[model samples]
Target chain A: MTEDQIIAYVDGELGPIEALRFERAMEADAALAAAVGRHRALRDRVASHFAPIAAEPVPARLAAMVDPSSNVVAFPARPRRWFDAGGRYAAIAATLVAGLVLGQVLPRGPAAPIGERNGAIMAQGGLAAALDRDLAAAPENGAYRIGVSFVSRDRRYCRTFSGNAGAGLGCHGPEGWALVRFVAGSGSEEQGAYRQAGSASADVLEAAQAMMAGDPLDADAERRARDSGWRLR
Target chain B: MSSHRVAWDETGEIIRFILKAVDGTELRTSDVTEFERALLDLLPRLRRFARALALDAADADDLCQIALERALKAEAQWEKGSRLDSWMYRIMRNCWIDEVRARKRRSETFVAEEEGLAVGEADDRRIEARVELGHVDRAMAALPPEQREVIALILVEGLAYREAAELLDLPMGTITSRLVRGRQALLEMLGEAA
Candidate 1:
């Protein structure tokens, strides 16, 4: 049997003719049989490792999303101004922003997404608010595009963003949205996604992936995070 | 009576209505039908497949959400006679590749991607099941992305070879070759055989 056929046979990928011939050869050859055994064992080992996630209870956010009832909700208008001084919230999920702003209404548009405070990089203006409340695809138009929200290995909530503010990652901590890594933005629309444009995004994503301790929050979990002011227990 | 302002919830995440229509329009569940239900039923498996692709739980679900949104939007276009699972997997895999370009990965060492999001593994049985799961998780994580994808679809998810090949748009030989490379790499990392 060819090497490919042998592997395919173990994977049950071989055609019947190929599988039959492979079996004959395997019986005659102990080393080949042993090799197949190892391959199968490894397959079983790896499959079992990942299979539990499937068995795990589906996250409520995800389950709610696919429910025909939840999926059919009206597209309430998108708010232009996410932050305002009035007692009323201008947008959905603005209640989560109350604790974030600390009762002081922040101004709009002028402040850049990245700023140096206490000699450390911090997210300013809309970027700060977006990191605190924005979902992955939500409007961060006033500042930058928030790509992915993940818990850093150190358990701090971190996010990746690109667009006018430059492509990089920032983590939320005592100092607010502290910039962990930064890459110069090309300021291109397609590149704004922090993906698929070039090696720059790959670098940023690698950093995010390295820093992430677990899966990034799905929408519901992100909402829950925002609801609780992103405090990890 | 003409206006139907959708009330935003206090938490403001779950939309409170499924078929509420505006302007006193007749409410309908026509959008859901069989497509949405089938999509919901396949969610668990799709999440597994997506997790295989995205390697992060939240990213996988986000990827899943995007794909589902697309699928629901294009429900009429789906060939109903075909397997919904395969079709949805196709959408998800394409969505993952297109949106994030989660490609260009060259790592061959474990970097700790999404570890266990164990839901009910605390019992005595799961503890036994987890004895080698960590080691296996590391071995699988050490593989190059290409090999890992094949291994995930074929060996881990148990898709038929042809199904995986067609879903990925690769030739039969190419699929087998990737399976071979992936299997050997996995075995090598696992220290089962060369």
Candidate 2:
């Protein structure tokens, strides 16, 4: 048999008959037995060389893709868009929420005008009306001061409002305007006047600028959307 | 099937025990199939095979990542009641041939830092063993890529000659001959009197 026979026999690649035949040849020739021994030694050495790699912990980047807990299809995670950063009410904490004013979001009561309907934080009474009406795009002198009106990245019409009720960003949803991001100007809206950084609406507008999908709605688009009852076009 | 998983878990018993003490890595509830769990179990072995194919840990992981993506993407193509390990091996080998191997040919560099990192916690004896391992690794690298792959399949990975041959789509004689040449070179490099 050639050297390949010795290599294959040592690696158990030989069939039963071939292995037995090779064993007989090894018994006959002492040098052949030594060659077999050498082949066995090499295979053992090399197996040891590479086997430890199997024991190393898989890298987290690679492991994350197969993690059953995660949505493996999206493991690497999509890049956050600049316009949608700290905006869009997907996950408040997941986005960069460094200095946003999220004041006691949607505190519900008989006197309070915000309520949760079917798990959605709904803007009740004047707040919802301000988000719904043409007055949202009007000048600063309106009753419920609308800082800006724009469509969110999700195509929902949203308005930043501050008044006697409270100040926050509310996006129009099926149930009504949902309080997506809140300004901490609610209960403290009386004498203390819900001022932190500056006027609540100013903070709302600034936060809205960072969080808005685009520029605040132009007067024409704002009027048209308002006339159509604030439905996304 | 759960009993089989328990058997697999036994291999990771120490790891699980440590994770429990540290409150690390709780598997969240998801619709995990036995097939998926089996694939998860094969990762370490696939990584070993990947290391045998590629140059460094990072490159091997990149190759593994590509293989995993393809494996999951074409998961429906995999046959039931067959060895998933072999199927995954085929997928990894294809990834190496198609993507990583071509990329590596353009700029291949041996990384000693990876070897140092592998044995960061090694004792003196283990350090000496690591030195020997490094020698073997260098020797394997010195081989032609073809011979190196053959050596990886037969010697390092312990595939049968026929299995290696079929997996590579080469004749058995060609595969055996390549293994013999690779082993001879490796033995000589290691200064074994073969």
Candidate 3:
């Protein structure tokens, strides 16, 4: 067998038929088996040698770049017009200011599919039903999959969801469920699979770490929240 | 309608809380914030890839930082729905090539052999393991850049052979050949170390 075939076998990249044939060849050939063993040992050593870096706290300089406060300004371009001294005019001015801010902050473009309700971007269409009805701990096969549910630091309910678009963290706010953090596909994991906490991507995990007010809601608490329309009150 | 208006009152505090939580560093653009957040999670993997490519720890981190800066500046070029990690890896590989060319222009000596195996800190008990890892690292650093990258992508980073080929803009057969030779060299060097 070629060295490429041996490496392919080690990586499990070969098809079943090819793999079966390779296995037969391996059983008969000691040198080929020894090469496979060496390759496997080398791959393991490389992975383990680098594994510790993942556990290290990402350097503060790197973390600062993603810190929401450092990177996400709410509305920096609001026009600086002075308001008149009339009470009614002040109220009108405040309303206009709110509209301007919402226009900047609310999801726009293609993301508009997730409708805006009460100033929050609610998961619409399939995502809404999944959040409203689907239990994360007991997942069902669907286009959208819910991974974990927890209360946010602000006492709002938030859950991590993934679908064809990508993975994101959506939290229930006064208006509706808002998409707070989203990462385009990393091409690491497939959607619709029942991904456990351990399998969550770094972006999903960081969003959870930043927002999780407590441990993830247990099945009983989740059901209670669902029954009560996902409301904390 | 009235409830939506009241929600604005809470928005002020929510915005303030988020800003405060991030220590008052203002997010200039939504796209930048989103991109940075996504890229932040991939740093560890990127670092590991850099470690394999650049060999020296400081050079690896430098390569990572340069690639990140380039990715952020050229964020518009990134096609949505594609794998961000793969795109970043391509940028990193380009950066390494440019660095190599620049070093050649300057006629500076390339990385010292001993400098190539610096894989972060190790404890006293794992001395034997560290030595083994050191040998592997040294062997990896000795390969030509082309062969080293194929090994890095396919062997260390776990990209499929096809994916590695596409990332390197090479044919599948070339990737297989390079990988075959690279692995043989590595095995021979490792055997000597053993």
Candidate 4:
């Protein structure tokens, strides 16, 4: 066989037919036989070189893939479960320790927004538009009127409204209308702005209530309510 | 009709058992359970493959441990009905490559740590095994990483040619040629040793 054909055979690239042809040729040629022997030896050496990996125990860290419960403690971000009161305390202590480790041991910043910008008790923006266009037009119905308003003993003006949308009070202030407080009114609360209006007591509304007693705004009183800055709640 | 009914009954019972097992655990946790089971089942195979890739027993075990950790984390991404064994081989290959890279980066000189090779060791039998293993390990480590991975999977893990090709994401011809070259290289490397 030609040297090229022998080389192919040595590399195991020969198919059955080509291999047989090469085999027959090698049988009669000593040099060709030596080349084939060398190739075989190369193959054996290669196999033995990497034949040891199949007998070791997989490491525990990797084995934890099967059982996270045993290994999860190593990961600090994951929360642990507490099955009892003691467990709960332990979990809390663990959390505090972890927090200390993270260097966040105290309350770091203002947790809630502060409220002194503009007294929202009065009408403002779309609310001011609503009050201007809609408030007095339906006063006889009393459904959306501020329940009462007057200059308070503190000498600050305020007004409270029974929201047409539900049960709650909104007050008037220099910035426009700020809702003081709201209680969720049942039934059809979803239908209008009053839904959220009475849902939570706004700081403005509470301050307005603290300023004024009963007896709501007349046209002149309402105008004054919209000009003067309401004071601290 | 009665024979068909009996076969159906057996099938129903098998399905029932599978359902109960699956239902007993959260779907995510169930996969974890299956993965752990597969790891335990594949431990011996993993060791064999590691040994083939790493020359020393301790190094091989270390490789296995790293491979197992990677496989477990990646287990969630494994699709249902995929072959876990092949998934594992790929993980092992990557881990071995990483360790090789790390060692290279550290420029760490590794002396063959087989205690059995130490001169004048008291334990003859243990030393003989260690020396033999150490020779094989040093020879394997000299091969290029690509060739070594193919050899470990095909010759050591005993994966089929097509399976190894798929696992390595290589063409069948590439796998065959690599294996052939790898085997030749291994033999040449070992033959030079005593």
Q: Write the per-residue lDDT of candidate 2 for residues A1-233, one digit (tens) a residue.
A: 89877776887777999999989988999999988888788778778878988766556566556653322222113212212332322122211111122222233454455654654556776566657774644554444667678888888888877665456777787677876555333323443423332354555576567667878888888888788887885
**Where's the lowest-lDDT run of ten residues in candidate 1 chain B?**
B13-22
Q: What CAPRI class is candidate 4?
A: incorrect
Report every candidate's CA lDDT: 0.59, 0.61, 0.63, 0.49
Tens-digit lDDT track of model 3 for A1-233: 98879988998889999999999999999999988898888777666666665555455445444443221122212212212222322223233233334232333444432554544445666676777788887786765678788998898888888765445667876555676654333212532222221132455667688879879999899889888888998
lDDT tens readout by residue for model 4, B64-138? 888877776777888868888888878988898787666544432343444333221212232356655565555
Arranged by lDDT, best first: 3, 2, 1, 4
Worst 10 residues of 1 chain A by lDDT: A71-80
- Screening candidate 1 with a backbone cut-off below 3 angstroms (N, C-alpha, C), the clashing residue pairs are none
Candidate 1, what DockQ? 0.15
Which ranges of candidate 4 are over 4 A from the true structure? A1-233, B1-32, B108-133, B171-184, B192-194
Q: What DockQ do you compute for every candidate structure?
A: 0.15, 0.18, 0.16, 0.12
Using DockQ as the measure, the top candidate is 2
lDDT of 3 at A233: 88
- Record all residue pairs in model 2 with backbone atoms less than 3 Å apart, i.e. clashing: A103-A183, A103-A184
Question: What is the docking quality class of candidate 1?
Answer: incorrect
* Model 3: CA > 4 A from native: A63-233, B1-32, B108-133, B192-194
Per TM-score, the best of the predicted structures is 3
Docking class of 3: incorrect
What does the lDDT read for residue B147 in candidate 4?
74
Query: DockQ order of candidates, best first?
Result: 2, 3, 1, 4
**For model 3, what is the error of residue B146's alpha carbon versus the real structure, in angstroms, after optimal superposition?**
0.7
